[model samples]
Target: MNFEYMKNFMDSLTEWIIPGNSVVIYKDGKKVFEYSSGYSDLEKKIKKTGEEQLYIYSCSKVATVTAALQLYEQGKFLLSDPLYEYLPEFKKMYVKDGDRIKAAENPITIRDLFTMTAGLSYATNTPAFEKARKLTDGKMDTRTVIKCLAEEPLLFEPGARWNYSLCHDVLAVLAEVVSGMRFSEYMKKNIFEPLDMNNSYYHTPNDVIISPQYIYEIQDTKNIVELQQKEHTTGVVKRAYGNELVFGENYDSGGAGIITTVDDYAKFAAALANSGTGLNNNRILSSATVKLMKTNQLNEAQRKTMNWRRLRGYGYGLGVRTLIDKAESGSNSSIGEIGWGGAAGATIIADTEEKVALFYAHHMLNPQEEYYQPRLRNVLYSCL
Candidate 1:
């Protein structure tokens, strides 16, 4: 792999692209390139390094999905099984009909959760989601939050549309209920330990120093503001940073809460790229399962209904985004590339067609600048 273009990319981060950032690329189950730039903690003068950990946001969904698939391999539950079978609270769900609410025509299934067609949403404007925010209030655990979500009225009929929602968190709850283990415990045993992702955690450990999160405001475009204390957001019941956030008595957000280093996440990505085998020689998932996870589960109509900005060339997979038409999507990635990103600027992409895994981690909050992932992918693929 070429280093010249990557060097220039890292230099741009130092030039105030988005505070500090790190990138790791693995090809053929081996590290081909790695780079880190700026400070992990600007106020503390801590330089970013391979060891630094950042919140992975929605990327955690991929890991959660992996755990569910492992359970699937064991015949724990079928994707077609009604979600109400696992969690009774989801039974008899309602949908908003004009200004009133009515019973849903059909029950939501586990596959609906995986494909994000459950009609559940995270939109704060909706009364249901607003209630969800108040119900969680950083106090309820994952299962409790899921129960609260089930009580809310869905935006549409199950499988009628696609919306990025708290479906994964519900899936995490299902994993817990079926496995009879805490969500984190199941993941630690089935995924993390097997793959040797030592630095990855559902909650930050006490000994681990979390890289400070930064918020880039429009007024201070060049200046990245560091958050001193952990900030809580709506529908999420944990802090945004630090040990209290991770180890705190709160929800295990299968959708958003994970802390990991670029190197560690690259290992997870490499495992996906290598067809379910990790660098440590452990098979965390079966090849058939990995193939299923990376396959596009959405139809063309469902793809047209997705609202995410970065999903132009992609379709919903079990948990990650699978590239379906690179030309139509205008993405430089391979057609089978699978990955997801965090609310912060972090992203990971595993391309089995090219035998490449790429990860980029940063702590900037709600980055208002132009999207960086496509540019980064184009540059990296060009180097290859």
Candidate 2:
């Protein structure tokens, strides 16, 4: 692959984008390109390395889903199984209408959570979610927060519509209950260890120094500001060495918690791209299971319900976004490319058809990542 243009782009990140960034691309289970630029801590003058860990945010969802599927492969639960079976708090949930609350027509199923159709919204301005947040205002336990989420009314009836939400957070608790292990423990044993992803974790290690996070501000058009520490009520907390909420004693968030480095994440991405086999020749997931994960699982209505602009030509899969139409997506990626991104400009795309896996990590909190992500895809796929 021609990496001249890619190298130029990486070099420009510190000047044009964020202070530090890393990119890694793998093809056929081998590293084809890898690059890092700028400092992990600009104030401290620490250069970024392949081992510098950063919070992956929502990208952690795919790992949680992969762990859940391992249990599914073992016949522990079915996609159609009602969530109430695992967490009885969801036995009789309700939905909040304009001014009234009504009983949900059906119970939320495991598949509904995977497809974002469970009507569970994130902590938002809505009355229901606001109340949900209050339940765990100063707490860190995953089961406690999830049960509180269940007590809150849904935004819509289960399976009636799709909404990006805290459904995966609940899935984390379900995985723990089903696997008879902690969420992080299950991931380490079944996913990270097998793939040799030594730098991935639900919590930042106590001894390792991590890259500092930043936020691009419109007020300072030419400079990025270091993100200050703040209390977060959404069950996730932003910290210097990655996020702190997932580090709670009993909380292992599935939606947005895992921290990893470029090479470590590439290992996970390569396994997905290579039919669930890691570079070490260990099977992290069955090939059939990976195929199912990459397949579009949403129906027409659910597809229509997606609110994110970047999901225009994509469809919801188990955990990642599956490219259903290359032309409509306005990119050169082949159909069936599956991946997800974090809020802090971290993204991973695994194209099974091209046998390519691409990962980009930057510690800048930029909502405009939609622009850069596809740009990266277009550049990489064009070279191919």
Q: Please report the candidate that would top lDDT against the real structure.
A: 2
Clash list (residue pairs), candidate 2:
none
| Residues 1-384, model 1: lDDT tens digits | 677787687666555446678899999999999988877776566888857877878888888898889889999999999999989998899999999999999999999999899998865354544455577674657776677667788999998988888888889899999999999888888888898988888766789877778765434233324221213121112135442223135778888877888998899999999988999889988889988999999887888897566678788899888888888678887887898887777888888889999888877766432356766777888888
Candidate 1 ranges with C-alpha deviation above 4 Å:
123-138, 219-248, 368-370
C-alpha RMSD in Å of predicted model 2 compared with the true structure:
5.3
lDDT of all predictions = 0.79, 0.80
What lDDT does candidate 2 reach at residue 15? 55
Weakest 10 consecutive residues of candidate 2 by summed lDDT: 226-235
Worst 10 residues of 1 by lDDT: 228-237
Alpha-carbon error at 44 in model 2, in Å?
4.0
Clash count, candidate 1? 1
TM-score of each: 0.88, 0.89
Q: What would the TM-score be for candidate 2 when compared with the true structure? A: 0.89
Decoy 1 TM-score against native: 0.88
